[model samples]
Target: MKNPCVAHRGWSSRAPENTMAAIRLALADPLIEWIEIDVHLSKDHVPMVIHDYTLRRTTDGKGDVKKKTAAELAALDAGNWFSQKYQGEHIPTLAQVIKESVGHCKLNIELKTDGIRYPLIEQKVLECIQAYQAESEVVITSFHEGTLYRMKRLCSQIRTGIIIDGWRNSLPKELKELGADFLSISYSKLNKERVELLKNAGIQIMAWTINEKRAIRKIAALDPELLICTNYPERWHELRAESMELEVVNRKK
Candidate 1:
């Protein structure tokens, strides 16, 4: 069975977080069976693949992502800050990323709604997914409950998940009510007891941004079937291989 190690932000530890350069590299690597990217509607209502609400952190632009038209967003240098060697790389629209990844691998497209909300973003993102006929290959997730609610209402058949970083007493009940397909939770919140709870509820679990070697092994030991979201998928693969090898040696002994 495949380990299902997801490349967070397109193998972001090596490439610029959400740029096409990152996405393309991840697609080319066979180790990365799943790629996670963030999505926000541009001013023109185009779904764009980017992590920040503002352009300052990842691109050379100055304002909010929703303020810029798709073309304007693509015009800025998104890779220069990561490294001068990647000077000309630009932000990719969600369509472009989907075009590159539709058949090669699955995507976990995060419906990014932080402080500034993009009104009607769920419909816009749905349009992009339908346009490419990638409804089956994508998993839409968000921290906002309303976003998931809207997405489920828009198309209940397409898989949707809720991203959680904290635990609450009502969580299992809330999740059961929400009817989410999976729970993408923070690494700190993942453990045997919680895993059993979610599994018993028939909810799939995904742990995110686990980059350290120790953390990777710990989670993999807890549940190898998890969709382990990591910045360095290469590291996860190495550790997974080592674990498998050790298991084989023990069996032979």
Candidate 2:
């Protein structure tokens, strides 16, 4: 199967990661078929686009993200950390993301677990998906096993991917039992033998945070069904050609 090239944190290189500008940049790229973004809840139980527990690093703020209300987070500058050109960009809501992404491109929402209020996050996320009728184009993923499990129970329609940062032989039995749609593991930890084994079992494998061309080539050779890459969305066409060329060379051998 042709692997889907997903933009990690949107086209993070073009704009601040997980912001409206980033989403716009990614959707404008024809080669980008899907985008992966992070989500977390604010003090008011509103789900917003962000990757960290604290806002100090990514935004012009200095506290835990969960401690701030949506209005407070909105007041901070989310873009200046990337570039001064976008100094006052506000954190986007899950509803805004869903609305904009509805028919444009597939979305992979990575639920951030640090300081999480599970029920609130799940409720807000599911509500946004329902509001936009985006169930067909959305997949929920998380590093938190509990979050993924709860998602599967709450909404079986949307696909679920368990994010693993380690190298383990046995796929989490709970993920399999809960009917997860796929497994997303770090590219550094995967082996070709395991890739083949998973493929043979009809389980989908998606490698995360792949950005380098060399790593892209290596993963393409393993032939996973999807690649969740960062910044590499800009080189989508070049990498795809590389994948095709590798296939031809393998066939001739």
Candidate 3:
């Protein structure tokens, strides 16, 4: 099967990351199968889809995102920073994303609980997934091992991935014990030996934030099960097509 192309934060190259506009753009593209979104809890513990813990980078607000209520966050201008073309886009809640994404595409929701821990985030996210009946089409991921453990304990049926920035010898063993479905890692950390180790351990591999052609091509050569790219999913699509063409030629030769 061709490796799936996961949009980093929707088609965030054009729209504001984590907004509904970005999700819609990614859904419109046939090449993208998985839409990766970051989620944080609002003051009221509503799961809001966004990347940073702070709102300054993506929104017109000036404080920690957790400090704002969902209603307050809804009023912020989330699009103007990227482009005026999307001037009024607002951050979307995880429930809204799940509802909108139903029958459209799968979601890779990365719980943003690394630096700022949000109590019961796992429960809130799982509740959203269950409410939408999207367990078949959702994969929950996080850098927090405890969060992943909580998710698995809450719902073993829910597919889970652990996002790691660096290599660890105990990662495969840990994932196995945690009942993780995959390993989401930085593109630079993938090597032949690591890929073999992961594959041997029955773990799926996903590489992230790859945009440049060279980096994308290099990671593609590793043939990860999923390529999480920002700005240029089309490039990944092109490279995959080219790789398939080469495979066909080699078989005939």
Candidate 4:
């Protein structure tokens, strides 16, 4: 099991995070196998891809994302904050992303729940995945316990994951109880011992937001199956190329 790279927010270092442009760009690359994005329900109950509960950070709109309809959110410019080149890039619906990624790669959709819990978001997400029969193509995750629980109960066929920002000694038991297929954690909290504990628990680890060359290598070395979630997939790809080159040079020597 080689440590695989998951493009975080879809090559976010180069494009706007969670936009269709970023997602498409990552999918275009033959090297990207998995991509992670955030999903929030609009006022009309459509699942849209964007990180925050509010739209101010990534869009020209200035209010809670839940207040707007999917079309309304789509009208806002989601890509200009990163650069003018993406000025007209709008927020993409989860269905659009699923349709776009049907044959390309897998998606890890994070259910965004900051303060207010969007009612029936779980059902909406399940229905969306079911509409496409994409149980294998999508994995739903969230920091909220109840969201994941509802998702598992609704459709056990689709995988569910926990987005953890901290560690606990009883985490293995907790994850097992929650029926998490995988767990994504901060890179700072990941180490060999923690990886072993989860592996023994029959759970997979996916480390988040690790960008530096050395840090990515350090974490990937711990477990070959570990999913190295990064903003720039190119860095990881470059590291692999460099390692192979070094291996060749060493053989020659």
Ten residues in sequence with the least summed lDDT for candidate 3: 222-231
TM-score of 4: 0.95
User: Model 1: per-residue lDDT, tens digit, 69-91?
Assistant: 99999899999999997898998
- Cα lDDT of model 4 by residue, 1-253, tens digit: 2578899999898899999899988999987889999999999999999999898999999999999998899999998999999999999999998988877899999998743578678888878888887888888888987788888888877788888998997888877788886898998898889999989988878899899999998998888889999998889989888878988899999
For candidate 3, the lDDT comes to 0.87
Tell me each candidate's TM-score: 0.95, 0.90, 0.93, 0.95
lDDT of 3 by residue, 148-246 (tens): 888988998998989989998899999988899688898888888888888889887888889987788777667556455556777777777888899
Q: Using TM-score as the measure, which candidate wins?
A: 4
Give the distance in Å from residue 240's predicted Cα in candidate 2 to where it truly belongs.
2.2
**Deviation in angstroms for 61 in model 2?**
0.8
Candidate 1 vs candidate 3: which has greater TM-score? Answer: 1
- Measured on C-alpha atoms, candidate 4 has an lDDT of 0.88
Candidate 4 Cα errors over 4 Å, as ranges: 114-116, 250-253
Worst 10 residues of 2 by lDDT: 114-123
Model 1: residues with Cα > 4 Å off, grouped in runs: 114-116
lDDT of 1: 0.86
